[model samples]
Target: MPPPALLYALAGIWISVIGLRSVLVEEHFFRKIVASNIFGSGVFLVLVALARRAPEGPPDPVPQGMVLTGIVVAVSATALMLALLGHLHDLEKPDNQEDPS
Candidate 1:
């Protein structure tokens, strides 16, 4: 109901749109990962803000903690995924037998 909540909702909407654009218009590996990350972050932020808006009584620390944990886990997962992809890419190096030009 606050200004910040409205801002978070708007940001979430924009981020979802950007992610959809990347999936619809981009065909690059990097773009896919970047878009996925943005989407994930936006969803988490919206959930966190919603949790923050819960009734004042007792307050829900669970959601707050979950969002924090999700953030760390998501970043680590992204790094591992990218690293693995890079390793696979290195293995697919162009052979001297043929030119990609």
Candidate 2:
């Protein structure tokens, strides 16, 4: 395997290990967020690796397209979820926001 390909494979493996460890250990909300970040990033790495060896024939548009779509969706979902979590926390303790009643 080429050096770049090998490096990518090793990185992918390491990221997968981190993801697994994240699951087995303590799972606080922040930790879970970190894990999600790792996992989504790992998937992106895999897609990139596949793209590295992508064939010239017949075009590999599908894989590229899917990865691009996934990146957008994952980023949006993560941002929304994090925002919602923060909002929930704020709701739990409304120090700044005055209560209506």
Find the candidate with the highest lDDT and give its number. 1
lDDT of 2: 0.73
Pick out the ten consecutive residues of candidate 1 with the lowest summed lDDT: 51-60
What digit string (tens of lDDT, one per residue) describes model 2 on residues 1-101? 45575577568768967876785685576677778778777777777666666434453566678888988998897898799878987988878777689
TM-score of each: 0.71, 0.69
Off by over 4 Å in 1: 23-25, 54-59, 94-101
Task: Report RMSD (Å) for each prediction in the order shown.
Answer: 5.0, 5.1
Backbone collision count in every prediction? 0, 0
Structure candidate 2, residue pairs in collision: none
Candidate 1 lDDT over 22-96, as tens digits, reads 857877777777887887777776776677564455546788788899899889978987998787677877453
- Clash count, candidate 2: 0
